[model samples]
Target chain A: MKDRKPLYLMTPALAWLTAFMVIPCLLILALAFFRRGLYGGIEYTFTLENLALVFDPLYAGIFLKSAAIAGLSALIAVIIGYAAAFAIAAAPSRRQPILLFFAVLPFWSNYLVRTYAWIVLLNREGLITGLARWLGYDAEMPRLLYTEGAVVVGLVYNYLPFVILACYAPLSRLNPEIAEASRDLGASSWTTFRRVVLPMTVPGIATGFVFVFVLSIGNFVTPALLGGGQFQMIGNLIYAQFLTANDWPFGAALSMVLIAIMMGLLTLQTFATERASGAKREES
Target chain B: MASLANPRLMLAILAAVFAFLYVPISVLVALSFNDGGLPTAWTGFSTRWYGELLHNRDIMSAAFNTLVVAVVSTVLATILGSLLAIGVEIRRRKGRFLETIIFAPMIIPDIVLAIALLSFFSLLNVTMGLHTVILSHVVFNLAFVCSVVRARLKTFDWSIVEASTDLGASTPVTLVRIVLPVMLPAVIAGALLAFTLSVDEFIIAFFTAGAGRDSITLPMQIFAMIRFGVTPEINALATIVMAVSVIALTLSQRLNRGGLPGQ
Candidate 1:
């Protein structure tokens, strides 16, 4: 009771993170302000040219495109995941835990395996094509793989479990009586959902949307694997800058931008959650 | 109003979403056993790819390296993370800065952390290898472990610790003899989770494991194989990797009902 700063227990782990995670991230931040050397080394001079370049029309276009893809994936994932979560929530309460478990099981698997699963399904000679041909559809099929759509599908597929998990929380906690009361007042089912259930669940939707968007925006694997490197998302751009273009400063700068976008979305998610709880408190 | 609770409609939605989620991975798993080893058609069943996998020296070595990294990192992460969790929970001060430190790794984009670690390691001229990969893995592994342990601590009774201290037991003795035993399931659950994450981590390992094939983990190997295209070996490998994670996560879930970070 007397000791105020008894941090002995946390010191080791915090020190490790500070050294490895915090210091490294800070190094990258500082590196963004420096110049890239002729031999791809980082030079010891400060400059904002790299940060300025992040908004260069060329780079900014990639940012916008990445956002679009990420936004689309997040949208689709939230829709489908919300539906799934709602279905699970409507099930018998005793079965809800197991249902949620099965829904989220796929998320635990390796990320690359999950992405490669899309590759198997969407390849030109893959299962979908085989099924199409078997169905006697003798028309030129649109390319199924290596497209932006494929990248979005990959992103959605990979992150959908997370959305389902997020949405299920609020849906499960929802007091059925509220919906009953809304309907008792002659509110249509859709009207009740739109005005009552949906409003209560906005925080979950916000979290799910932000999670998928933040992950998808900087995703290198899905685009690389499914987009065939043609749709150079911000992720692949960062990859090339560091590994191939040998520009450490630019890569650092690009990641800084990515971090900023992530932080902004996360802040919004936090705000939504806090506001939601605040409103709930007023209701009580 | 009946539509909202319509069992048939709810079942259909669940079926479609689950199919959408599972069908792709299921196909990959099914194809791994195809005797013909062709993406186009399934022949008879065989374990030929798994057998071939055993003989692939690079994959064998990569698996060995992955195991080494996973085990070592999980041990470090569990010990440090459990201690960190206890430390954070026991203290009266609930600092936002400390919470952010614990939370950042779980949400930070993988590539950002990977590149940051790469830059840091190279700046210090640390020769990158499995060692460097282990170092980076602990950064996130400990965070995940901490979060999981901290979740179990939410329901923990603090009065017991004060009581134990009042009975003349030292702080470390009370923690070791009292708190650790109570949260042992969570600690183990967190360790299994950390092991799975370290085993499956790829992007970070790919960057930090510089200048040699010697440091390649299983996921890095799988990524390289995947980029080459659809091959029987990759399907088989993906099946094994998926199975490992699924099994580990299930155990973790059983050990701590609310083990997952968000849950």
Candidate 2:
């Protein structure tokens, strides 16, 4: 078998990754420990001030808010997705793949476009407004496009397909006999679901939750567009710092914190997935 | 499980979920053809927005840049990614470290990677432009391409390679004459996926495209248009972008029967 030559062949991918991924990530890590320049460039002097600024009440508040909003979106998406996946799984096996494909099809499209779709629906002059007025309500309409609720809705809609995809896998792979056995053992449907099905699918739920949360937290577009200028998620803040504010050092610092949070959550998710899988193995 | 057999609830849920997913997209697509300036009003059907898109120089240039970036990045990513996948799959000794590092690009947050690449380029005095966007995009694009190709490789039969080798074919000759033909479909599928990602990618391009309208890509143009307030032009642009993605991914999935990446 080819050996050394193949390893050499992998060098290009490795080199590209090292140059663009590893090195850049390290550069940001280094930037986080440095001071911001007065003119929006980096200062060579090493300091913890940038990192410290990340924890300041103002920035920390933004971080917490981003996390909360992301959490809410993830939670909502999981519930909606779980229900949908459950329904799909219940369908005849022959039709399941097509159902699953449509469920996930929209997600593969442009992310920005999907978020913009909500803008068309929720903007003051958008469809919802037109519909509301046609229904004869003359009251002052609520602002819909640029709000926290709109952001959550956008995140949920954009990510629902993925949540369905994640949740559907375990559901489809589930052995119906296990559920039937539980049913024959006299457990209620809800009880069997809670104790048997839910436990079995905990890994999927965790995966979906983590996937949604991570993407939503670092998501700049949805909040920027749907939440409008008022909403500042971590992603938006980082964007502003780098582009508008031109505070590269501080932006790098904020990005580091964002990565740290993502990594932490991802690590926790891995543990959760493994534990659930371990339990499943025990059941087997 | 029992409750799921209830057709009424199942159908309702399915309808609701599809509506939630499809409504916004349909609305956007429908609005693109609306003659009225506002999204709510559809006085007449017109292709005016698409016509307006052609006349708009800023958007046209952005579209051109997007095409250039997507094509260049996808080509480079496909080549490197296909090689990497073949190499990784062929090797008997697959290191966990190598696997994890290769997969890291797919999982990393875009914002983080964007800033990281931005800082890395600025620090290295590497001028940020379409080239930088292509380079940064290839990082993730290659990972995706590798994944798709690797999935195909998993179901690949290795005995053919041994047979070809036993017949005294050289390594390169064997790969060219044997593996290439078989893996061609997956390679094309991977290239399609990479193209789709590069086209849709915004944040990475936003950061790396440098500060000027000259280097702006379609997503950047769309972003500027949206922030400047929605216009019929944006609806048109968004429609085109989404259509491109759907077409590319549908084709990719057709070739690769497994599933789309990140699924």
Candidate 3:
């Protein structure tokens, strides 16, 4: 017992991850280089055609659309989430925890349910339409469900809590005196906020933005439910390719691209954070 | 102050944001209790829909399968993750590669992982069912559980275990009696979190479920039902599912203290 290493204890869990996650992920990489079989399985011969097809105009259009939706969702979520976080940070100190807790409480609930809630709200015979009809406005409103806008709203709803949590960390930790100091030095309120407040919270903003974008761009459920399958995002395309289309090789290639984009953004975020904080680590 | 000087503005932002966050959920919850069970009007309130859940065989079986997955996965994850957390903290080396392997499960897109596992299992010619879903779930669940337990271990008193060993206790005994007690809260919190995640999980389970009715979990059932369209029954089902997760998470949060699950 005395001679036993603690590293031995890590073996089982780490081994499980390596087998299930690591191996599977590597398999996906291997899968991308292979050709699709006539019977819709992987062929033994290797080729770069699948990877190249990811940039084919049709798929690239979906990627561009996904990026646009993801970007818009992230942007909107950040603005709203930042304001909510700021409001939470400004409340009486005793109530801040409660506000923050409730702010994120919905996030902990089922993601599907949250998405379904929007379905109920936006459906033709749904709550909003019903309310509108009851309020004497029945002139054939444009259908809301199954649109790109609905997809964006659902994406924003699902990820807003994460942004709130992300932004709240920096906002809560911000020192009050800095703002007052800038104000005392004759900086206007807006100027003080723009110069003194927002810059310091860049890491949080970056984190929130990256998270929303990454999750949204690859999201299948929200678009499937809210977009009513009217539009295809990268996620739906991947789903179709793998499950419906039986093009596993192509799906794997698309995933490789998705993973590349995710890793690149994360690496950039890490660099940004380090650059932002590198100046303050004089002693270290 | 890290606050808005304009109280009116703060109030307005908080009100609007909270409304935006909560209104849809509130509508769903309200409809679940509607006696008329239509979005058109609030006829009255009743628990009939809740009662109706008992008679639905598909949902009942799906719920049972979900419970099996969540319970089994949580137990395995808790044991393996606690050990992993303890082992990592006790070791001197901070291997970045090891860190990435552990954290990748947490950060990977659920769809990518789902497809990856689907491909892996198919390539291996393994039978896909509830068992495979359990296996796939442990990949992420253990990572989350490891993270939670590891956070507690950061402030852990290592000397007690050393003292226990010096006082003639074996390593296993010291861990069981001393370390486990200190880590019990985090371990439980981790288990609760894992349970909710597994219960609510859909995509991976859907892929691994292998086109079978028996292995269908709650979320997969919900997905199928949702694709067909929304009904009052779904609203009731959604309400119950949401409540279960919210309660589990709230309890987990209480046990962990101050730190939310993801953070």
- By DockQ, the best candidate is 3
| TM-score of decoy 2 | 0.96
Q: How big is the positional error of residue B54 in model 3, measured in Å on the Cα after superposition? A: 0.9
In candidate 1, position A2 carries an lDDT of 34
Q: Predicted chain A of model 2: TM-score relative to the true chain A?
A: 0.97
Which portions of model 1 miss their true places by more than 4 Å? A1-5, B1-3, B258-263
- List model 2 lDDT by residue over B1-263, tens digit each: 54425788888999999988898899888889989867766789999999999999998999999999999999999999998998999988989999988999999999899988887888789888999999999999999999988988887788889899999998889888887777778999999999999999999999998887699999888887787666788888899998899999999999888443334
Candidate 3 residue lDDT tens string, A1-284: 23247778899999999899999999999999999999997788989999999999999999999999999999999999988988888888899999999999999999999999999999989988888888999799889899999999999999999999999998888888888889889998788888888898888899999999999999999999999889899999999988899999999999999999999999998888787677546624
Candidate 1 residue-wise lDDT, B73-165, digit = tens? 999999999989988988877899999999988888899999999889888989999999999999899998999888888888889888998
Candidate 3 Cα outliers beyond 4 Å, as residue runs: A1-4, A280-284, B2-4, B258-263
Provide per-model DockQ scores: 0.67, 0.68, 0.72
Q: How much lDDT does candidate 2 score?
A: 0.89
Q: For candidate 1, lDDT tens digit of each residue in A1-284? A: 23453588899999999999999999999999999898988789999999999999999999999999999999999999999999999988888888888899999999999999988888888889888999998898889899999999999999999999999888888889899999889998888999999999999999999999999999998899999887799999999998899999999999999999999999999999999989999999
DockQ of 3: 0.72
Tens digits of per-residue lDDT for model 3, B1-263: 44325888889999999999999999999999999988888899998998898899999999999999999999999999999999988876788998999899999999999999999988889989999999999999999999999999898768877899889998889989888888888999999999999999988898877877799999999988998877889999999999999999999988988543334
lDDT of 2 by residue, A92-173 (tens): 8889899999999998888888888888888888899889999998999999889999999999999999999999998988
lDDT of each: 0.91, 0.89, 0.91
| lDDT value, residue B99 of candidate 3 | 91
Cα displacement (angstroms), candidate 1, residue B56, comes to 0.8
